[model samples]
Target: MAKVIMVQGTMSNAGKSLIAAGLCRIFKQDGCRTAPFKSQNMALNSFITTEGLEMGRAQVMQAEAAGIAPMVCMNPILLKPTNHTGSQVIVNGEVLGNMSAREYFAYKKQLIPDIKRAFRKLEEYADIIVIEGAGSPAEINLKENDIVNMGLAEMVDAPVLLVGDIDRGGVFAQLLGTLMLLEDSERERVKGLIINKFRGDKSILDPGVKMLYEKGNVPVVGVVPYMELALEDEDSLTERFDQKEEGLIDIAVIHYPRISNFTDFNVFEQMPEVTVRYVTSISELHHPDMIFLPGSKNTMGDLKWMRQNGLEAVIKRMAEDIPVFGICGGYQMSGYEISDPYQVEEGGKIRGMELLPVVTVLQSEKKRCQTKGKIGMLKGCFHELFECEYQGYEIHMGQTSYMLNNSVQNVCENVISENGKNVYGSYVHGLFDHGNIAYRIVKILAEKKGIRIKDGVFEDYQVFKEKQYDKLADTLRRYLDMEEIYGMLREAHLE
Candidate 1:
């Protein structure tokens, strides 16, 4: 069996995911074969593995830190919210069905066998496993049926390191309150407490840290400082979306209510000359060199929302003047019409932005794959993109059919416009992952705006991310007591 250690947070965005990722990096650095596991994840942010299996992007990031390929077993169950009440339930990389809160709550306990099986599979492959829990373990109403947090800790006999965000304020309360809410058995499972996202000098927080150790009766394992990293974020709770700063080249991305895989745009932020803003409303959206419609979990509904909020009209009018691009759900929305025949989404046909000569029909089955192909002949704003070989992944439940004219050519399953205009879209995520593609896009945009881009602003995506993981590991090693963490893992395995 693999030695196990789990990181649980006092609240959502309490820095659990990043901390867990840091540990994964540490374990890998120590030459321990490590894997990250989560019994369940609830987020629209997700990734498709090379085998076409789906998993949470958080686990994918952790797997990257471990220097390993991401697998669906890392996140056995994923719930993507479609509305306030219901979500699309994905079990082991395939959709089980849509379930409401009441229905899933009653049914989740049945997934124990699945979780156990996945964990066992990980143990066979790893010397150690870094597990992450979702949200807080202190929800009394939901604790009984919990398969994450303390419940999962007990299940896998994994010791927990509870993390609280000091930057959010009330860190003391957050940690103590969570400990207070847990049952005695659950509390004993917590090996240590960590104060995450702390700013300022260590001496100023010394008294508070001492108080926390005395009151909580758990060792203060670490006080990690707030870090500004360009790594991928876990979910919509990410602060990357609210950024409104402008740069030499401004690119606006429409923020849907249930956006998924917004990491596609993260590569764009690598360049100092470019600014990418997530526009929630028309007022937040201003003139930009390019406009992007990102992937959404609820495409039809978001399109409707765009219509009611008048963003759709603005985008359509703006498409006439500037370059417009879309991905996945956004690609579906940019067509002539979208029809959900099997009610995969809210049923019925809806009018699209009419930007492309394509029509999309949502199917009951989803296609998930890592695909690569040569870029077809394109025209207009990014005609330079043509003949450039690119690689990306596809995760969508719709099939689009477009009438190809002189300009539109098949770049795998993507589309482009005629020479005189700039409207294009693709179902592939990570379209900019090819460093040169990202670099070239910036170059094209800068040229159009009559600006100069700085050199050495981009590198291979894998290289950039690996350096980030190392930076994270170095920070954790400097502040966190790795000896204590290793002891916890040892103790868990011995029993």
Candidate 2:
């Protein structure tokens, strides 16, 4: 059996996923075949593999870190929230069904065998497997049925490295509190603790580390310095995003209550001059060059939310001047009105921004697959920019009916837009990843703002990320006690 070591965190967004990726890269660089595994992930951001299978983007980034092709099995189970109380479950990259939080908890255990099978397959080819645990294992109530944290550790009998963000302060408390909350067996699984995202002098933390070791009865393996790694974040509250200011384009994205696929803008953020900001208040809408309405799991509810926040009126006012782009739920919101007969979100016809003379009807069937189509001549202010064909895909639930030819037209049957500036919507996410498509839009926006863009303005996002992973791997190699980590993994395999 291949050596397996899990990276569990003291809390959510504790840098567990990033640490896992760095470890995977380090192992691969050491001439060992490595892969990343996460028992389960719950997030709105997702990616479609080359096989047309859906998976969390974090696993994909980790795969890239390991110099391996991404696979659906890497993330066998994914839960995308459709609303606060309910989520759409995806097993093996296929839509299982929608389940409420309570229902999911009751049924999640039965999927353990599937997770084990996927892990076994990965182990067969990999010399090492870096598993990531979701949230925290210290949740007393969830520990019983926990397949993602301690339960997964016990299932695979894998040694774990508990990671805590030292920069957040209370690092000792977070680590100690987690250890205190875990059962005896769960605590035994933790081989060491890593103080991650540390800043300032390491010697200053020596006393704190000494105290931690004395009290927690676990070795302080290493104090990892705060490294700015440009990788895709696993969840909404990404620390990387929190640190950076908006880029150049002055993009104001409407913050929906049930936003899904906001990760679609990850590609746009690659441009040095593009600024992507999420705004909830109407005052923040300002004079953005472009307004993007992102996908929402709940269309009618988000539409209702827009009206409640006076965003419906604000969006209409902005549409008249600048270009408005919508995707999925945002695309549904671009029509004249949206009607949900099935009571998907409070059940009824809701008034839309009425920018485009179109209507969208919510349906039961959800589109949960990969798409690829060429971008043609999209009629809009961006036409001169996106004149050439590009490629992308679509994922949405509502069906749109356009009232006029000018109201909506498909460019190469992929990109969608209304007469010039009023409305632009598409099901395609990650459309800006393609450099040509990205540069064209930036060029137009720059011209509109009386600015000029130099050549190679939009860097290739994948290449940029690979460079980031390389730097991250180097950082991990320097700071982390790799020998100690390898020894723990070997012990797990022997067991």
Candidate 3:
């Protein structure tokens, strides 16, 4: 059996995923076979494995940090929120159907067997398993059937490292309050406490750290400094959306309420000459060189939101002059109409932006797969993308077909565009992560706007991500108590 160490946070977005990824990297560097496991993940940001299995992107990021291929077993259960009270549940690698919050809460306990089986599969290949927990283990109302936090820790007999976010303020209350809420056995499982995202001198925090240790009866493992990492964020709470426009090339992204896979645009942030901003309202939607529509979890609902908020009209008017691009759900929304007879969303039929010459039918089944193909022959503004070979993944629930005798042409195998060619739509995410795609697009827009770009393009994003992982491991090693962490794993082996 593999020794297990779990990272649980005081609240959501408390750096649990990054800390687990850092530990995975550290373990791999120490020459131990390492893998990451998250029993259940509830997020819109997801990934499609090479084997065509769907999983949460958080585990995939952790697996990458550990230098291992991503697998659905790493995240056995994924809950993607489709609405306020419901989610589409994925078990192992396939869809199990959508369930309301109450329905899933009652049904989750029955999946314990599947969770244990996933753990056993990881144990067979890994010497150490870095487990990541969702939300807070102290959510008392949710503690009963929780299979992702303390519940999973106890099930696997894994020691926990409870992490608190110092940057969010109330670190003391967050940590101590969580400990106060846990049962005696659950509290005992937490072997250490980590204060993450610290931005000040350690001396000032020393007094509080000491008190926390005395109160919680756990060692203060580390006060990790705030480091700007170019890593893929887990979900919509990511700081990427808060970025202010700075770069010469401005790309405005419509900030949909249920946006998913926004990481598709992370590569643009790597370029010094490009600025990617998320605009929510008409006031914030300044005239940009290009407008981008991102993937959404609930296409019909979000489209209704756009119409109600006046974004639908604003984007259609903007598309008349500027280059407009859409991906996945956004791609579906850019078409003439979207029909959901199966009730994938609340609306049965809705009109699209009419930017593309196609119609979409939302289906019960989802398409999840990794694809590689060259961009088809294109015209007009985005002709730069012509014949560009790119690799990306597709994750959506609808199929789009061109309207009869429409002048719009297929841009790629999975992409379509209007005849005017200023508007483009595709179901492929991560389309900009490949060779010169983002660069060429930005360059063309910059030239049209008469703005000069000094830097040509960025390095391979995969290489850039690997370097970030190394930096993450180095940061953890420098700040965290490695000897103590290693001792925990060693003791687990002896047991």
Candidate 4:
């Protein structure tokens, strides 16, 4: 069995996920077989495994840091929010059903057995397991049925490392207030305290750090510096959405209220000559070289929202001048019509953006699989990418029909398309994961603007990500007390 250590944050987006991933990388570098576990996760950013099973993207990122293949066992229960009050619950990579917040709160305790079974499966092969907790353990009302935080820590006999985000302010209050709220036993379970995302001098924070130690009665373990690393985020709270910068090649992604898999465009953000901005309104949509309609959890509702806010009309006008691209739900919305006979989304028929010669039907059955082939079937803006080999995954519930008589290229085995030879859409995610596809896209955009780029065109996305994981591990080793952490793991082994 693997020795377990749990990381619990003071609140959501307190950098718990990255901290856990850093530990995973550290363990892997030290030659330990490490894995990450999160009993429950609620996020729109998700991935499909080789088994065609769905799991949260954060665990997949952590699995990458550990240098291992991602498994469904790493994340057993995933809750994807379809709206403000309800989510579609998935267990062991399969959909259980949708439930309201109140309904799920009352029913979550019943899933304890499934969580345990998944943890045991990870234990069979892993030498060390780093578990991540959701939201905050101090959410007092939900503590009774809390299978993700202190409850799971107790169940697995794991000591907790409580993390407070210094960047969000009130570092002392955030740490001490949370300790006061926990039950005595739960408070005792917290073995160390970490202050994350510190941007300034250590001398200035020392007095407060001592105060936190005295008040919370836990040893201060680390003060991780704020890192500018390219990593996948779990939810919409990511700061990437707030960036409004524009570069030589401007690419705007439509930021729907329920956007899923926005990670699809993260690669572009890393390029110095390109800017990928998430636009929510007409003001943010200014004259981009390309427009991307991203995946959404509620496609019909988001499309309606765009219609009401007048973004839909503006995008249609812009599509005549700029190239427009979409994926999955976005692809469905770009078509001529959509009907939800199976009620997969909001029931009823609706007119689409009509950018492409295709129609979609929302189906109850979701199609998911990994795919790889040459990019030999596109037109217009993607003409430069002909025969460029690509690898990615497809995941969606809508069945699209190409209106063949309407000048369609039916590009790339129907995984991507060229309509009117100007508009494009694809059902695949991670299209830029492995090659110069991103480079070619930028080159196409730059050519349109009559500009020249001098950077090298080839990019191995996996190799780039591996360098980032190493950077994370190196940062943690310098600031964090890893010898103390190793001691805690040794204690777990002795127990």
Candidate 5:
């Protein structure tokens, strides 16, 4: 059986995911076969494994840190919020349909068997499993049938490291209050406490750490300083959206309400001349050198939102003069029409922006796989993209067909659009991840805008990410009491 260590946070975005990932890297560095587990995860961001299984991106990121291929078993239950009240539930990489908050709460307990099966699968492959918890475990009202935090810890016989975000303020209260709310057995599961995202002197926090240990009855294992990382964020709480007009080349990303896989554009931030900004309204959608439409979870719903908010009209008008690119659901919206006869997404056919000579129809079976191909013949402003080979992944529920016309052309094996125009659309995510593709796009945009850009190539994204994992592990080793952590794991395995 694999030894297990779990990280539980005082609140959502309390650094649980990153901590879990850091531990996975540490365990891998220590020559242990490691894997990450999250019984339940609620996030818009997700990934498709090699076997065409869907899982939370957090586990996928951790799997990368552990030097393992991402697996669906890492995240057994993924809840993607489609609206304010309901989420599309996925179990073991397959969708179980949408359910309201009230409905899912009642139905979740029935999934314990499935969760256990996934854990067992991970146990077969790993020497140690680093489990991550969703949100806070101290919600006493919702603790009855909980299986993500203390309940999961008990099930796996895992020791817990409770983490609190000091940057959010009230760190002492967050830690002590959480422990006080838990039942005696649940509280005892926490072997250590970590104050994360500290931005001040360690000496100034020494007194509070002592008091936290005394009140929570757990050792203060670490005071982790806030480190800027370029890792993919799990949800909308990501601060990357806050950056606007920072670089020489202005690239605007239409911020849809249910945006999925926004990480597709993370590579652009690596370019010295590129400024990636998320624009939500017409006011924020000023003149930009390039415009990008990102993937959306609810294609029809987000299209309706864009129409209602007057963004649809603005995007169509902007496409005539500026370079407009779309991926996944955004690619669907760029076409002439979208049909959902199978009720895949709220049902009924809707008119698209008419920028591309294509039509999309949502299907029950989702396409989830990695793909690689060279760019085909291109025309007009985007002719620079011609013959460029790229690699990416596809995860969508619709199929698009190009309208038969001499003007329209297939840009790639999986990408279709009208030629002799600036507008382009494709279902491939991570199209810009390649340094060559990203550099070409930036160079073209800089030439168009007459902005002088330095001659330098962007770093390979995969190499950049690997270095980040090493940096994260180095930071954790400096602050976290690894001796005590290993001791807890040793004791758990001995039992």
Candidate 6:
């Protein structure tokens, strides 16, 4: 048995995932074999493991931080939201059908064996397992069948570290209230408390931290400061909502109801001249030079939302002369129509923007493979020798066919665009991952707006991602008591 230490957040997006990842790095650096585990993760952003299993991207990031290959065993259950009320549940990387919040809670208890089975495999090589909790365990109403938080802590007999986000305010109440809410048996499992995302001086929070330790009787292990580590977020809530300013271009992305893999836009956010914003409402869709319709878990549902909110027209009007790009589901929406004969998501058929003479058919079989291809000269106003290298993975159930423009040659059907500087669509996510491709496209847009981009504004994503992991590892080493924590791991008895 591997010694486990779990990190439970006071609320969602309280930096629990980052902390868990940090600990994973710390353990790995200290010469102890480590792995990350989360019993359940509800997010649209996911990755298909090498074993052809789908799991949350957070654990995958953590596993990478630990210098381990990601597996479905890292995250046994994943929920990819289809809409507000329901999501498609994935058990051990296989879809178990769609279920609502209420239904999933009742059904999840039966999957204890699956979670254990996955963990058992990780325990084989891991000397320590860093666990992450979902949402707040303080949800008294949902704690009964809570296989994610304190319930999971109890299940594995792992010591817990409750983390609170000071940046959100009410840090004292958030931690204390959560501890008070947990049952005696559950509360006892929490060995320490952490204050995360602190912005001010450590001395300012010292009194409060001391008070919490004395009053709550929990060890004040550490106070983690707000560090802008460029890591991939689990979902849109964390990634899209960030108010960071990158470049001069004010690129707006539609925050669909079922947005997935929004991380594709993170590359743009790193540039010093770009500002990426996610807007869900039509009024918020201010006049921007470029607009991106990102990937979605449910294309039809989000398209229906686009139509309902009159965003489809906004996008069309904006694309009259301005640039518009779509990826995956958004690519399907850029076509003439979307049909599902098998009715995988909604019944029958749906319509899409007739910007490009293309159509899509939803099939039961999903396409999940990493693909590399060249951006051959696409039919657009600013077409140049775009024989650039681009690579990304696919994770969609729809098969798309394109009706190319008469003049366009040597083009794949997967990438169809209007014969102007307007509409563009591709099945590829992270199309901007290639620095040259992104720089050229942005340079074109910049020329139109009379903005000149300086040299070296583009980042090589392959290099940047590795840098991000190193930053994550180094940040953990600086903030956490890695030596003392490693002592705990060394002392832990594997029985």
TM-score of each: 0.97, 0.92, 0.96, 0.96, 0.96, 0.91
Candidate 4 per-residue lDDT, tens place, 215-293, comes to 7789899999999999986576899888898888999999999999999998888777788999999988989999999
lDDT of each: 0.88, 0.80, 0.88, 0.87, 0.87, 0.80
In model 4, which residue pairs have backbone atoms overlapping below 3 Å? none
What TM-score would you give candidate 5 relative to the actual structure? 0.96
lDDT for each residue of candidate 3 in 1-495, tens digit (9 for 90 to 100): 788898999999999999999999999998999999999998888999988889999998999999999988899999999878999999998999989999999999999999988888888889999999999999899989889998888788889999999998999999999999999999889889999999978999999999998998999999999989999776857898897765778889999889998888999888777889998898888888888899999898889999999998988888888989999999999988899998888757999988887888888888889998888866569877888888989988887877777554433366666787699888888898888888888778878989776574567788889999999999999999999988776323321
lDDT (10s digit) by residue, model 1, range 209-320: 8998899899999999999888977675899887889998999999979788899998888777789999989998889889999999989999999999999999999888
Model 3 stretches astray by more than 4 angstroms: 406-412, 455-457, 490-495
Q: lDDT winner between 5 and 6, please give it.
A: 5
Off by over 4 Å in 4: 405-415, 419-421, 455-458, 490-495
Which lDDT tens digits does candidate 6 get at residues 23-125? 8877787788989999899888877765657888999889988888888899999888776788898998888888997898789899988887888888887
Per-candidate clashes come to 0, 10, 0, 0, 0, 6
Q: Check candidate 6 and list the clashing pairs.
A: 246-272, 246-274, 247-273, 247-274, 248-273, 248-274
Once fitted onto the true fold, the runs of candidate 2 whose alpha carbons sit more than 4 angstroms away are: 239-248, 341-346, 385-392, 404-412, 420-422, 491-495
- Which segments of model 5 are wrong by more than 4 Å? 405-412, 490-495
Count of clashes in candidate 3: 0
Candidate 2 has an lDDT of 0.80
Q: State which candidate, 4 or 6, has the greater TM-score.
A: 4
- Which residue pairs in candidate 3 collide? none
Q: Which digits, one per residue and each the tens of the lDDT, describe model 5 over residues 1-495? A: 788899999998899989999999999999999999999999888888878888988899999999999999999999999889999999999899899999999999999999999998888999999999988999988898898988888888889999999998999999999999998999889999999999979998898888887777799999999989888765757888898765778899999899988988888886776789999999998888888989998988898899999998998888778889889999999988899999988899999988888888899988888887887766557777887889878899997877776444333456554665788888888787864888888888888878766676677788989999999999999999999999878322311
